[model samples]
Target chain A: MSTTVVNTGTEGKTWGGGNEPLKASYGKMMMWFFIVSDALTFSGFLAAYGFSRFKFIESWPIADEVFTHVPFLHGQELPMIYVAFMTFILIMSSVTMVLAVDAGHKMNKTKVTWYMFLTIIGGLIFVGSQAWEWATFIKGDYGAVQTKGGNILQFVDTDGHRVALGDFVVAEHKDRTAHERKNGLWFVDEGTLPTYTVDEVIKGLESHENVLVRTQIINEEGEKTVLSRAESLKQIKENGKAVVEGANLYVNEYGSPLFADFFFFITGFHGFHVFSGVVINIIIFFNVILGTYEKRKSYEMVEKVGLYWHFVDLVWVFVFTFFYLV
Target chain B: MGHEHKLEILRGLIKFKSNTQKIWGVLILLSIVTAVEVVLGIYKPEALMTQVLSMKLLNWIFIILTIVKAYYITWDFMHMRDETKALRRMVVWTAVFLICYLVFILLQEGGYIEGVYSSGFVKRDF
Candidate 1:
């Protein structure tokens, strides 16, 4: 009896029966697999966002009205321009990343370095612009009032122009003390005070007869539903609870509180990706400077990072569509 | 690609001896698509906003254009076009299937919720 182990046509000592079925190396294939899973994670988040948006379709904030600010052009109604520019910049960074990968293929360290530098710069600009956008969104433009039913009520003049709270709200100051956890009984603390109370906003509305209350609901004319002068006074006097000046997890001056939550979560997640991408690019940039890949006779690492950068850009495309365009 | 293979792009339709030019070309295509998307979003022409197939026509355009842009970014910038066919299918097909399934489930449920909200059976006006 022959007890010799048969070759079984798999002579190598590795897995996969000793064949690269996809014709890709171990690293590249694993990277692709990781990307697929990550893509699914992002899809899950986007799907949740879609569900919530659909749930509140009628009262959802209009993307144009919410994202009207453009940097260096304060108080201008420039819709979709700044986000488009951010998209363009990220796409260009992906281009430079691919160029770096191509240069790495040729063992041209100089070109690789230059392209990698440009990619890093582009990433920095994207992250910075995103921060600016978030700040602007959080700080909100014109303040609004929240109803007891948790609806945001904005003010618009007779000409359909928005009116700021500070424009007409008389700034009356009264001595007030914040209750701190340490100083207060039972270790509870009062929340931060808003710039104005509901009474102040109601008084402001009464003083300015031209101002009207605009609800978040859309009318048949595709504009916000603006109440009549009489209705505005009645609505404010009856339903107004607190003055909501900006966006947070609990309140939003835009429309729905969920809108602010999703905006912060989704965009913050994407920005985190861009942040990590920049860090990875910087590490690879240093490796290129060190001539490590050159010595290895391959620039596949740069190519891998290029894959990730492009994926980030791809995700942004969908985000821009779902969050802004659609 | 290894040291021996040249970095040609566009399936050799436009042979980039340097590969840098091909990168720029792909970028331009993506930028054009994005420009169109932004213009459509800002203007939102009346005709396109008409309802069609359970969704607005403008929204469909945005989704389709977004998919096109994603394809280009993956195929060109990520060098998926240069990889083996089996690898491409394995990665792209799997993602497509899962994403479609996920969107189907969530959006179906979302429509149900919307119906409930509009039907006035559920008291959400707290």
Candidate 2:
């Protein structure tokens, strides 16, 4: 098989004519096109995110406030630190990938293998970090009150401090025992979990006395009064139980169910991209170890992935600016 | 003739490197502008906040700064600046016209949605 080399120095070299950038073969050109299209796909996602923010102009949840948790530090509010670390990891991986490509240019096999290995590890760590972040977000904090009108009301006294549902849960109810997974009636034979039903939380809300529907206003500590202790207890009482199962999407003890939805959708989409990127990097990494590109006397494969890694970093820069900063 | 053509191509690549440096400088400037935007957004000045501009003075500043960054990213990082004039214009114009159209449609529709919410179609509490 013939390899194509493309060089920025050559101009007016038609498709079939000789002298392309880096002597890039057809595969490399196709990869470039793929990267461009993929870049556009990411831009479309970000623009849609921007459109939604514009749609909910006044009441959008502040991204910085929502994503304040950092790994390795429990109970400490670290803003943008985790995402910044992720950004650094991605950027550094790009650097390693680029170096590997440079070594490939000089036909240095050892350097290529070493740098490719580092880049793959970087990608794996990034994907793992993202998984941890998703877990934390899915298991939410400081839940909200659902109003009859489908509005989520979070609570705060005049002081504006987020009062936990536990603090206000003065009355208690006996929670029902869960049905075994096999014993439960299966509509289509799906497994069941031993968790409180949504009905229970609704009944508990009805039974509670002191709970008030909270709003998305800032409490004294200047946090979202999305859900208060009193309101959550009330929800459980109304539902005739103590626990609420399922995602706290709409009107959960958080003030805006839309906030959760957007959070899950946007970040989930980005996380999916990161996951796919890592998987692709893994394939390339294995190929590098197997000396596939080394046989060709070029590591343009690494360069191509480097471009993708940098593109991901570039998108994150905007995401951080808009989501975390703005 | 071949050697002269090769020299010309090498010179072009060299020139492109200097242009890239300029783009990097612009990126640094844009970074500073972004930081300013964050600060303004966080501690929104009362004057700017209360007497909003036609498109929000603060928001306009952010959009302009962001556009500047986008322009440089397209031109330098994507190397459109070094391409044939037709190629350069094709990419830039496409992005410009499309982004404008998207923003216009979105804002107009969004305003209508806000109107419906205010009119009690979707009741909101302040």
Displacement of residue A234 (Cα, Å) in model 1 is 1.5
Candidate 2: tens digits of C-alpha lDDT, residues B1-126: 010111112225433233324433444554565556556655656565332453456555655665665554444443334455654454456555665676567667766776676578875553
lDDT tens digits, residue span A58-138, model 1: 888998999988989977899999999999999989888988888887789999999999999999999999999999998
CA lDDT, candidate 1, residue A156: 91
Query: lDDT score, residue A20, model 2?
Result: 49
lDDT against the true structure, each candidate = 0.88, 0.56
Chain A TM-scores, one per candidate?
0.94, 0.73
- Candidate 2, residue A42: Cα displacement in angstroms equals 3.3
